[model samples]
Target: MTSTKDEISLAGRREWLGLAILALPALLASLELTVTHLALPSIAADLRPSGSELLWIVDIYAFLLAGSLVTMGALGDRIGRRRLLLGGAALYGVASVLAAYSVSPAMLIGTRALMGLAGSTLMPSVVALVASMFKDTRQRGVAIGIVVASVSGGTAIGPLVGGWLLDNFWWGSVFLAGVPVMAALLVAGPRLLPEYRAPGSKRLDPVSALLSMAAILPVVYGLKQIAADGFAWRWTGAIAVGLVLGAVFLRRQRRLADPMVDLALFASRVFSASAIALALAIFVLWGVNYAIAQFLQLAHGLDPLTAGLWTAPSAAGTIAGSLLAPRLAHRFPPGGVIAAGLVLAVAGFAVLTQVGPLGLLVTGSIVISAGLAPTMALATNLMIGAAPAERAGGAAAISATAPQLGGALGIALLGSLITAVYRDQFGHDAELTREALGSAAGADAFTTGFQVSAGVSAVLLLVTAAGAARFLPR
Candidate 1:
């Protein structure tokens, strides 16, 4: 009884259900990114990982995920998005189980890397599928908003989820949470989701794949090193090599008949501007999130669960802002709306500089998160929209890659600035300088770090706001 038109129509019960299924993988991927931060202490106590090993356990997932996104995205276009999604889901579920049961730190780190590889496939496929599924402009906007919101929401709630699990269960319980979610997605995704692949797509190039990994992994590793051990020559060297490899990757893309990434996509002003704005927006988001978590725990002496609960309002604000963005964009110029959101975030950061009270910090976090969410959502929509229909997977991959790199760079650079300022205040007092300058000086040092970091975050947001207004197309 179903006509061809009825089968392909965008608006339907099946499409909506499929969207919900797609959101699960995106949410789980983002949750895994930050969930480990809360469990590190418990992991350390149980596994007895050295400082360097602990850092590896945390960094490997993101490093591999960011590195593999483009290659996997392009591969999905050559193969099938649905196939890639299901395959990744299976791998992710298996990896989660292994990670949950791992007795050694090395075993855990290896499984986390496998999860990242699986995650790389899931992220791009979900976004590209959303882009392909929603043919209407308005409907697509809302779909993208929902997908983007899940990612941001997951990031916001990751610690809270981890904290609650740690409170009631063992550290391994954090890894097990994803097992059920992945299972549900794997079971339902095939039945509900449509298959998509770029017509006439060429085979993936091995050299470009390796080059892409080489370009991204070192940059992320260098940033992690800067965050953990401060700036070092080796880290700088690693970054330099990454930049050179990145240049090579770009040059290779330009010459290839069937490139892994279509270099010409960046020619669209909307794509380039939106991508940059999204990256900068994420920089502010991740950096401020890290700084605020520290403030809640150290400055206010709140327990992990309590601190996470306090930040929950900020996550709510983000979801509200994302849902509200499409209506605002309809009424105002998109560039202006995005700029206005950044300005609001700047104001939020300004409140943090005052270091008034817990209420003020919470108020600032809500405003900043809410304001930033709209820019991120709209910018992501613009990036995906600007690309050709066939290149949706590659475009989504680039868009996703920007935020991963931005978050790493933001946390490293901004967090280091806060650490340096906190240490400077201690004036070479070794006792006071231990454990992030808060163990000895108590709330005073935490307050200083909070104020300094807020100042930096505010200034960056102001600059980014101006850029968004100037560069993002109305």
Candidate 2:
């Protein structure tokens, strides 16, 4: 509807290349997260990281990624999306090599955070690229679908691939694996990806960018710390700072010449609700998935490879949901379908608490993922679908931002809560810590920590479900 928005159909070589380039970042981002999770135990042993430190290594990237995305999205609009993508690819490759060589947990986590900066440039560009490449509405839908599918599918596949790598190599090998993939993307990206910039947006806002990071980092860091030490003043201070900064950031954005988040979009109930739903869905799914991975390895005594195999049910369900969402969207509005998916996810988590018998836990995961996958896809579609064409980049950025935040929050808050509950049950026992984390901490401390992580995860899931029903449209 906007004049600056071009109209052309995406087809043939140009369209395919554009979409592939776009999907590459999503794949990389998802891959980075998935591989880290599978490698956590290995990293724990090699680095001898404390239970809290291990959570930080696993949780920090998402927070950085989420925190930086809004600013990066706006930058893409001011600069050129394709130029940003190429630079991001190069940065990702360098970070990958650095990550592979990390001698300590601190180094690896720091490298991962840097990787998040590169990744921040990758996602908004991808969505903006699709909009730039495809002029026709129908073609745009298809392009978005494939791009979305590739990223979502990569997440499902990450554990399987990570499992394979862990079987044969050190945990660092998983980080090393990014090199080839990123190298290929870097080389192909420049030639295949076309440049795009917002026609009218020539200036970028510095204040908003700083505020955005301030608003996000504390909350994310706070949540991560909570996993190791529950209900502490330190955690409370961090969260409060983040929340207050976030409020200030939002206020500044409204008056900015070139704001990262377009406050006006909330007027469209569809857009706002969809964004919230997307975040909530990720919060629930990934949070639980994190616990499930640990349980598979620790309780079931499965190797990373075996854990991946068991998780195939959840992955398959995600794929099934993606495949079915387009059709379901026609019968049920995108919002309604997303809301339904939340209900199903809630049921899945509830079932997890009860499934000690008849593989109840494992069986419940499939049902939960089945519901979540479609919801993820639909929420993504709605976030952009209702936006003004010229603001697609902003809309997509909002969509991505929520999930990044959700992922960090989910792991931090839920992981911590689970650890608290797990520890409470142990009641200051030496063997409990020794048996629980194995080598994560002092005897009594670590067991208490791990259970808190699991319990927090369950409680947050309930909150995520509740949020979906109340804030999202049915």
Index of the highest-TM-score prediction: 1
Q: What TM-score, computed on C-alpha atoms, does each candidate reach? A: 0.90, 0.88
lDDT of 1 at 437: 26
Error of 2 at 76 (Å): 1.0
Model 2 C-alpha lDDT per residue in residues 296-326, reported as the tens digit of each score:
6666566888777777657677777776777
Candidate 1 backbone overlaps, count? 0
lDDT of 1 by residue, 1-474 (tens): 977765565577788889999989878865775566656656766888775676577667766877888889888888999999999989998999899889999999999999878888887888778877886667778987898778767866777897798789888888888888889988898899999998788899999999999998787667656655566999989999999999999999999999988889999988888888888888877777766666666567665677667776787778888888988888888889899999999999998899758888789988998889888778878888788876776787788778766765676566656666665676644344445423224568668877888888889889988988988867
Which residue segments of model 1 deviate by more than 4 Å? 1-10, 155-160, 226-231, 298-300, 422-443
Index of the highest-lDDT prediction: 1
Model 1 C-alpha RMSD vs. true structure (Å) is 3.2
Cα misplacement distance, residue 20 of candidate 2 (Å): 2.8
Error of 1 at 79 (Å): 1.7
lDDT of each: 0.79, 0.72
